[model samples]
Target chain A: MTHKSLITSLIVSGWLALVLVGGCSIKTRALLFDGVDKEPPPPTTRVRRDLLAEIETLKRDLADAQKALETAKAKQQVKTADAPLPTELAKSWVELSELLPKHRSGQVDWGAALQAGTIRPQAGLDPTVLAYAEFNLDITLDRTKSPTMAARGLSAVKFSHAAHSQWLICDNCHTKGFQINNNGTDNILKHDYCDNCHGTVAFAMANLDTCDRCHLRLP
Target chain B: MPAFSPLLFALLFITTVANAAPEVMGNITYQRQGEQVADGTPAAIFPHWVHRVRYKCYVCHFEIYQMQAGSDKASMQDIIAGKSCGVCHNGKIAWNIKFDTCSRCHRAEE
Candidate 1:
């Protein structure tokens, strides 16, 4: 072979080798790393046949336990659905609302209206109604701040029990938040109270300048 | 030349991509779903570190198994048909699906 031709052949061979090595390295690296997100802890038990069998038995038992728990939760939900509201007034008020729409349009004397027709009781208690009954007690705040609470050196807030009740269970806050008969003296609506769940667990209650999120200036 | 160019391009592309740190196999045992398995077998605990040392990721991932957890449903029939764990353990490569060594994979101690 000519001297120049030999040099060209050598160059070509080197290029080919580089290409092959590069490709192989990438493939190897990806294979070794893919799906590995974090450095997981070491395994406790040996991956032995006997050990594996025991693990399998344990897993089956765990599945049965989980299934039983789900069944119990389902039964509890059914029981709660069937049970009546605590107060006679709450039960009667809900019943009266349903009958008024279907049976009588005008003036509902709750007891008389309820007696006139088969009381198609409300399906459990309406969450909004419950929140309203629980929070909207007749006792007005003596040191009540205006609707625009921000002007009174507090957060400009418009409370939405309806929206809140959608995600949170009643007992999660009910007596815990304020009182069943709230005198409106408690600072439950403040950041210290709200941020317990908001910033930590749920979406943050930050960006105070974006006042429109919680506070709307009533007309 | 046409085929060679594509292969060359692939090689260049792979080499050009930024390299991530090598994966350290810390937690070795991955729990496979026992609920899917019939006969109430416990979920199989796959020792990933053991297999990782032996084979490359592409040998199974997007091939015999998926990259995500709970995605690859390896059945006995599929294994016997030379799929999944069966690919190696199908008697031809490693151990055959014999009755005595059933606990080796199925693992039913209780």
Candidate 2:
């Protein structure tokens, strides 16, 4: 073969070898050291990790607050007699009223309980209707901030889940009772959305006595 | 005139040395849970390099840890009882836990 042809052949083989070896080395480097200098994975964020424990504490607090509020409310009729509420009962009543709001705002108020008459099972109402009546849930309205939104509450409500969950499943109201449009249509405080069922079957969703039943912020 | 073989040999030796040099292990940080819930404190930050330098991989890999993130629930109580981290961190082998050196493993400052 000519010297020129021989030199060209050597150059071609060298380039081929370099390309193959370089490509292999690049793959090996990536696979071996993909996370070498990268920061370690962050700790897992726990959601409701102590849910059972919280539930247990809530039960105890609710019982205590119920007892206190009942004692105070019992004296409501005897205005002329003037039976002062027990100090502990009065304190617990105040604490209970503020309880759901504080919990909705993300400050875990395990010691707070619901007012005594607030969660009573109505005797005259049907079992199914009673289920919807007792369904109480604390919902925080701060949607944009996310994980930290609970800490900041622009507006919030204590929804009666005990009243709803027993009679209706998630699908019953998730999309039907309210629009599934998650973009921004989730404010339960709106009169129209709540009035859909409140006035139709349940209590009317007016700014009167029915309003404070769900809206704990009302004076 | 000198042959080009010696120069070629020298270049090959340098290249071989460069390729064969021992790989330096990177520092690894593992965040442990349960520490926060137990005491309302921050999670523990474990520096893997400190332990790996002295012990082999098999020493703790499958036996003590399952090689999965958040799999091992090593509580302070378990460590005190000579399990998981206590295997070595016990008073006999490494730092003794009886000395209240929780900050050694836990982010007590945070």
Candidate 3:
């Protein structure tokens, strides 16, 4: 082939290989190191070496953890005197918890008690509606200034005015328990808003389990 | 009997019309935040019928708020400081700010 023709062929192949990158991300880099001459992959040769170094660090952590456990056990021996084994302590709590009903977060699953006819709350706390009521309002609290919450997969909050109004008067929250609207949800996260009662009267927020109790799927 | 029936129908129409009085209707929208409103800043909504059901016009007339909507520009800052809405929402007569979500009053226009 002519020199100019050969040069043109090289340029065409180079453009095709560059297009194989697919996207400007490390994920696309996976296609490169295969010797396809697409793009350079992240430093692959060091990955295994770095992981081996991490294993050594992890071994030291395990040894330190075991030593800390032994020291804690020695301290416990002085307090209990009988110093029950860790397995024995686990059995005791398991047996004790078996007596109480199942729970989701800190909140109890009242479904079991209500079904068994075991619970009978007073008029103030009762949820059953025996008579006609006055005001009716149900609001979904979805406002949040924190951009991280949505990314973290947290759903909006659910509130029912009809339920609370049965036991409490408007004076209980008009400007006190809550505002009409526009109040940021930051207070709810700080354990000051909904947590005021939920943490004490009911189950407080308990990790991801608490998310199911309040942030239900938006239907 | 036929003459009296026409007279009774006329009397009923007058009674119904007299009972009806002109009044400010529907909800009052407060978008005083002004042009270029974003998604989350919030708008203050004044639900008229809900309050009119319990209190008279005097409850929040020229005293608490002006007779017109544009006359009042109650912002969140003003409400929190015990001005426009804070007077009653100070945890005494009504609930205070820390009680619930701010969206209670500050909601996007429907």
Candidate 4:
């Protein structure tokens, strides 16, 4: 080959080699770690590690909460097992029995009974109705052995005269005694009876404002 | 080939937003405490949300009912005649306490 041609070829080859090397370097650098150092991806990696640590912490917290819940449940079970049974209703039953006329001998003049304080009128209750309740007490006390007989006597009475009082006083009378009406029923007392009488005749009983009259407040 | 894709980025953003958890309603039921005054009867059904709206937490939690759930002693007679929750739940204020309405407060056994 001629010297001129060889020189031209060498210069062109050198220029081409420089361009290719520059292009390759730019591509390789861009592909390798162009934005890596700029953004400090190590911080992202650290964040991922922190997230994993947080997840582990959350799992630990969840486990601790579960254990605490189980402990609380166990303590509650123990407390319930050690607790005493409630006997409020039983005591009330005894008090009611003591108030029955069967415990007293001789005829009870309901009108005089109220005057003598043998049967006190419940607060917000009608005095006349309370007197009628005395009559019911006399019959029930006389026929304690035969609930059927007592019920029959009660049913036979012209309850219309003191129907309001009967309903107010013995809301649970049938519920507590009669198997047909109150058998296996808890709180056999009917609220409708109380509402009906209280709503019509006695204003105190109407709004449930006189609950404290019969029941003592709990401390 | 193009190195960036706008559509891919938009899809990824949409997926992340859709996966967020939803808020739940606050309606909850609580059990009653103490002995069963009446056997075969379920515990009272306390509507948490309904009560929460009427009064503050302190009313029931501190003033009336204890903070601990199922720790108060309530009787059916007391409630029907107006006591405890029945003080407000009486027929005039809220629902009537009739034989048919027993199931409203006394839910069936689970």
Candidate 5:
């Protein structure tokens, strides 16, 4: 072949070599992206597995608690509706409120009204009456003990503690009308004390004719 | 004829109860003013049945008094200060000493 023709052929061969190298680079890039074509793998955190289990457990516990609460409420409603089996009156094992009569609104609980204090039960000698003296205590104010009562010839004043303590609490008369230490009927003469309830409540006031109510001796 | 035993039992029960005093639990009397026997001041008579009729053992026992009698020797001063019998005898709870005096608790032992 001629020298110039040979040179031209060499140049052509170089261009072909360049085209082949470019094709190889393109093929390598295709191979590098072969594994990445498909969809991404699922998330790693076991969000669905652990959280769903915990939520389910919590929900069941909550439902059980609600059911228990509802059952207790139903039982309480039935208990309130039904009367309990009879027991002894003075039995301490039972709640006294359960046996008490329906009291007035805003009034004190009579069952609780009974304090855990001392009781002068049946202070009087009359066997005919027991329920009356269950809370009753009869007190006598000796005229010899006081000069004012002695001068008036009133041997003693008969105070019916049973009549007062049954319906009224200690606070009703103590400190309000009488002091805690003042045990006599000395406060009875005061219009603010005895008359506050006696004349106002119901019982007729003891006039001059009822002088025996204060001084007469009982057999 | 079938109810004969029950009828007899009830009759006997009522008769027995009726013959006895309503409620009397041999009251205890305490008369000790530090070793020497107390004088003229009557020994205080503790009516056990009177308290037991309305209250349980816990009402007075271990609270105001001890289970063993004379274990708790009470003083008038302590009582007036709201201890022992004074818990209820404060003129409000039950009978006040101002009205009761010595005869209420301090009675001649029978």
Candidate 6:
């Protein structure tokens, strides 16, 4: 072969060799990327499985919490339904006075028996009449007797009848006094009772401020 | 970006205007003076609305509470269970009385 032709053939051969090396390097890089891509599948699948497990656990916890809440609410409802009547008045009466007067020996006449009678007329009679009648009978019957005797007689009256003991006790004790004296105010009555009975036999009446149930005026 | 969504901005503005303390409501300051068995160092600022709902004026004004504003000598412990605030605030119906919730009912000053 000629020298020039031989030189051109060598340069062409060198170029061809460089191109082949570059192609091999690119193919190696592509193979490396393919291997790396295969590695992520196991970890990604595990993460997805873990997330599903967590979701199931959360759902179970929520169901348990809801069931516990329902049980507690049902128990509370049953307890409230079975509770007794809130007879604070009856409780107060028993604590303040329970025994009746066998004999009379004081300023008030507790020996006198309460006579059945209709209540007198007064302002706001519908609310106050029943209370008034009860007080009048209690006061008159025990006019010349001790406080103990009066309390006993007043307490002996049955509370079943609205115009009887319930009416009387609410009026004479819880409501305003029958007299116009300043001491007859509901506030005064509660104070006097508390001073006498607190920490003694009856529960302290110091906090009873709801007197409108018996007294017509706002006082 | 928009400063705030239209709905969010409107809600924030309404809440700011409506939550202001009432102007006409009267203030209440209660001095201890050793009337209560528990801590008696500082007085309380009782909100009138707290009592108005459960009881009538007669309950406190002429009966349990004296007509005179400063005449009452109630203490913190005086109304824990069913005495003062306890009459209605007993744990069953209202807030439970405890040291954690002290500021809700008793304020040292105003």
Top-DockQ structure, candidate number: 5
lDDT of each: 0.48, 0.48, 0.54, 0.44, 0.54, 0.43
lDDT string, candidate 3, B11-44, tens digits: 9867764563222223466764545275545555
What are the clash counts of all predictions, listed in order?
A: 5, 11, 25, 0, 1, 11
Whose lDDT is higher: candidate 4's or candidate 5's? 5
lDDT of 6 by residue, A92-139 (tens): 222212221211221111112112111111222122322223233322
Q: What's the lDDT for candidate 3?
A: 0.54
Candidate 2 segments whose C-alpha is farther than 4 A from its true place: A1-219, B1-38, B108-110
Better of 1 and 2 by lDDT: 2
Q: Give me the candidate number with maximum TM-score.
A: 3
lDDT of 4 by residue, A133-193 (tens): 4223322112333364355442221122232332233322334222223222222134333
Candidate 2 on B48-70: residue-level lDDT in tens? 33342233233454557644335
Interface RMSD of each: 27.7, 30.4, 20.3, 18.1, 15.8, 16.0
lDDT of 1 at A166: 32
RMSD of each: 40.4, 40.5, 29.0, 30.6, 24.1, 23.8
lDDT of 5 by residue, A1-219 (tens): 699999999999999977865566545645655653454445555666678899999999999999999999999998854433332233321233344332333221223324432222332223233332235668777875556666666667677766565544454456532443444545455644555444432233435544554466532
Clashing pairs in 5: A136-A162
Worst 10 residues of 3 chain A by lDDT: A118-127
**Can you tell me the CAPRI class of model 5?**
incorrect
lDDT (10s digit) by residue, model 4, range B36-59: 544657555454423322232333
Candidate 1 residue runs with Cα over 4 Å from true position: A1-219, B1-40, B108-110
List, residue by residue over B11-88, the lDDT tens digit for candidate 1: 876765323212222212234455654555544445442343223333454446544345567667887887777888
**Which model is ahead, 5 or 6, in terms of DockQ?**
5
lDDT by residue (A161-181, candidate 2, tens digit) is 554543344444555434533
**Interface C-alpha root-mean-square deviation of candidate 6:** 16.0
